[model samples]
Target chain A: MLTNRRTLLAGAGALAAGRAFAQGTGAPIRIGLLHDLSGPFAGAGSVPLSVGAEIAIELFNERGGVDGRMVQAVAADSQSRAEVAINEAERLVSQERVDVIVGVYSSAHAVPLAQRMQAQGKILWINSAIASAVLKGKHFTHVFRPTVHSDQYGEGSIEFLAEHCERATRIAPTQFKLGIIYEDGPYGVGVATALEENARRVGMPVALKEGYSATAPDLSTLVTKLRRARPDAVLQVGYNPDITLFLRQAKAGGLRTRMLIGHGAGYSQIDRLTETFGAEIDHFCNVDPAATQMLDPSRLTPPARELQQTLLTRYHARTQSNDPPTHASMGFNNTWVFLEHVLKPAVREGGGSIDAMRRAALGVDIPVGGTIQGYGVKFNPPEHEMAGQNGRSVAVVMQFENARSKVVWPTPIAGGPPVMPLPAGSPFALR
Target chain B: MDPFLLEAIVNGILLGGVFALPVLGLNLVFGVVDVVWLCYAELVMVGMYCVWFLYTQAGWPLIAAFAACLPVVAGLGLLLHQLVVRPLLSSPPITQVLATGGVLFILQGGAMLIFGTDFRSLGVEMPPMEVGEIFVSGTKLIAFVAALVGAGLLWTFLKFTYVGTAIRAIARDREVMPLMGVDPRRIYLVASAIGGTLAGLAACLLVVQLDVHPFIGLSFGPITFMICVMGGLGNMLGGFLAAFLMGVIISTGGFWWNTEMSYVVAFACFIVVMFARPRGLFAR
Candidate 1:
């Protein structure tokens, strides 16, 4: 009787295991989010980006979680250190065995994370590290970027300068001399190089290209040099501290130009910038990855608006802050794309295999206005030598007026008209 | 001289004055205790945060908040002296250095954990005072004047006051000063308090101009140390003068070349001066 009972239990356990395996729902899908959750970039970048990922996971799970199998999302803080990011990535992939890794704030952290993910044959949907080197001449099937690249930021900046500077300052595009100042780092240098390349392409003259340490005590001398150069406009790429110090010193030293534009980084931090400078931040322009819902409400597509509202509501409910955070919008949109286009497809077609996911990601061909950020998802193939970059992702230029930052470039989707020439008495007016 | 060159020089001088204020206290503690408070910059950082919390968050007036920063920092300085610096005073200098270094990490990491690394600036926007073509930022000028006055007061106290004499005597001969009826431990504690007060003043002045963050102290730390070394360790006046000179050199270097080159030139000047005068440029 005892032998018969033991045989029956063993048979039942075997049948349950086989049934679950046959249904392709034996184990839950694990997603890892790596971010600088406690570092310098946390307040403006990482925190919001993580929220975006969380919101995506929540919505995806709510919709039945990749073919009836529950999805698990886990996050680890990089502490804004590259070594920490490496350790976290190792744990996420080797220990937790996550299916996908998403969100890294800095290029220093992102580069190593990307290499690790590729070696592990997993997917990495880059949230913000837009260094051009990450994608140029390299094709990693597992590494894909949904946000605008640094080079694109440069190109977008010059294009905006040519289109808006001429109208705002009444200076002809050919006559305008652009002064470019960038932090001496990979992100800044890459963007600056792109700015120069695009300036040459658009027939705009670059008067001075200066690179400075982000932590330099004062920028008076740099401002003095730019003043002597007498550029009609100045373009800068810098981190938060550098941008804050530069603007303060420039204002103190009375450095004036027709137009002043920042290509992402510090400029994209709208709430922090306003808190620090109040009205002083007005009249400046920033060219950054476009968050379509952040533009004037009327311009947002209904679907995009709904997604944005959901993200903001979820974020506000969690953090209790007044305004919707900046980096989360991109984070949510990027994760959403991966879930909708890649993960669900792979789970259905190939039993949740990574190779299937990669193939699905490559074949993704969503048109513009389909994603929450108003960008399409079409990864370039090896023939284009741009295998993993989102080719259609375009950045927008925003102008700050009366404590409001609104997209004012790419006329078709502009939030408002660009305020040109700055008022005569303004701190940034052209000499 | 080109107007811009002249402007850079003037701004450099003012920047030096602002830089000097923070280093003066570090100079004092390093001199008397024979211990390098490696966490000196973090002391100033803590003071800045105190000012921020009291003024910005609590809705206290700026001056009152500035005044509140002093006692709080003084208490912290006293606590640090008792807890960390006092115990290792007799150990090897390396032990003292490492202990203080631990304090630095604790304070920085603590600030990051507690306050978070969001940039917080004192929103005192006094317009620049324009005289002809020269524009002087009101906040910077106020800091410069405060530094000058604070330096003067510190000089008078050190030169004339009884406790100041005891502190100096302790610095000159720590062993003999106790025999002279002045308690060395007591003097060190008092000196630490004074140093904390100075940091408080510097923080209050700087918050008007510069933003406050967790690792901000690191940004200002090395250069301030360089200034102290160039001024002659423990020599207040020397540090003060060296700061302005280095500031001018850096500003002019930046104007003529670039920002990194300016720092290189400043470091080069420090090396040349140290090699030529082992005691330092302004060391008595």
Candidate 2:
């Protein structure tokens, strides 16, 4: 009888607290933008990513923010340091009391931030960190990755290579010798492991697999080895500067292959690559999660095109360049989805409670064509190991044609057919 | 010998020649000033940015940009010596190292702010020179020839010119040279200026082949320092020989394995040689 009375009192106290929160007593919803603003990653990633998130916030406010309550964002720079990211994350949560968190550009920064968000039961929407380990188990339920992981690139490349090689060279997949050169990092290892598995499954011969540090001074030796192997195809996993170095050295060292596929970290930013290498960068290909905003007009829905234009304009305004960094598109899409489908719904119903936000996010199921990237957002089954992964995420292959890059694989979305037999050759040839 | 091995050797030698100029400058500054400029690599980075800005952005001729890089960087070097190096000259060696390290940060950060971290290249392409079975990059060959010419001129100047003679005397003993009517401070500033000019020349050579970014120095810095140490910290000839030896070792190792393993092999060679002769490769 005494226990029943205590339970009744506890329930009444909760109801009173809810009533107070509902009656204009609570503060506006706060979202924290955690990104690397100053370190090594700041240039290629953080600045544009920050702008992408801010654009999303700006767009939301223009539309009368979530359920008539103001949404404020607290921004913190990670300084491209993992330790700094941890400290900044703590400050964002403890002092700022952020309702949601977004933005991470590298696995080094993302891994720790994911753990914290999971522990705190707060949400972290990942934009660019592609390491598969981030979504490995049940521990990452609070982390949602709309961007495709590293493994997807491997599978996508193999699929595209199989078709392109058979159609162009009339060579069976089994006869093709593959060479892999990758940076010795989480991102590279993850993609390489997947590429190896997929290659084995498809009965392709693996001739060489070499790993080098990202900051390696020269790639002449690796290129020489690859030249000796003379593989039908080569897969490179690296960042911007190393990609530039490797390509230049490979050409200078006289290393040639039938096809060179880059698992897009720096390669996806084709404008920068082109500006650095010019016409010499032609015939290179990269596989990444499709950013339909930058794709051919026919591939995008009307709404996506509008959103893309808005994002492009905002990015151009900030960078004073016609080209937008790839990260900016990703940043805008991820943040836009969270605000439109998750935070707004939760705020409308539950006075911006974290639990309510999580529920709303889990229930979100935007169709493939609905998103700006032309891919839907639906979390994988809760029972699966990849429960945090966006199930609709698929990889797309992009190839450099002349100076500009265009999507060339997955026929429905391809801007053009794949450029095969890497050295200058006909579009339709069997050699 | 295998053709591939022969080509690798040739490439290594050429690379060593390119590396020699910057290392030579580093050795000169160390010999005379007794100060290790940790920001030496960053100075090269700034020079590269200047080349990019002058040639690519401002549409200056490549030759003009190359010429401008020298004095511009020499001015920067003099300014640095005046502000940072001279102030802490009498302090402990660690203080000098720390101050130089601060300059490195400033240069790197300042470059990023000014250049915006976008990778810029000169887009200067020259057809590879085919020699027998191997193809040699024309740009690298030019860099090698330029290095040889620069080294020759520097050697000639030191032997023939009065100012250069005084600079050399000061290197022998800064305090003792004062009795010989040489101002050590003026010699130190000249040495720093010469060092900067050499770095600028290296930047012009490298900018053609490599992308220009704030972090470009890091790729060459540690290895250049290693070569300087292995060649004898202050001996110019020793440093050049050590650079070629390191280059050949690195190239051969790279051919046999990967860049990382090649670096390990080069480091191992340096460690062994340093132990065998504490004074360095050309120890008198």
The number of the candidate with the highest lDDT is 1
Error of 2 at A15 (Å): 36
Best candidate according to TM-score: 1
Give the per-residue lDDT digits (tens) of candidate 2, residues B131-245. 6657677878898899999999999988899989998888777779898788889899999999989888888888887887777787899999999999999888899888888
Per-residue lDDT value at B155 in model 2: 96
lDDT of 2 by residue, A1-431 (tens): 01121222233233223322343234656787777655456544556666677777777665667655555667777766689888988898989888577888877677778888889888888878887877777546678888888888889888888878888767899998899888777777788888888999898888988888776666666776776777888888877578877887777766667788988667766767767666666777888766555476555677767887788787676565545556777788888888888888888887668888777778889877677777888887557788778888777887876666677878777876876776555211113
Write one digit per residue (lDDT tens) for candidate 1, span B126-150.
7777777767777788889999999
Could you estimate the TM-score for every candidate? 0.91, 0.90
Looking only at chain A, give the TM-score of model 1 against the true structure.
Answer: 0.89
**Tens-digit lDDT track of model 1 for A52-156:** 776777776666667766566667778767899999889988897887888887776777777788888888888888887776776777898988888888878
Q: How many backbone clashes can be found in candidate 1?
A: 2
Q: Which ten residues in a row have the lowest lDDT in candidate 2 chain A?
A: A1-10
Between which residue pairs do clashes occur in model 2?
A: none
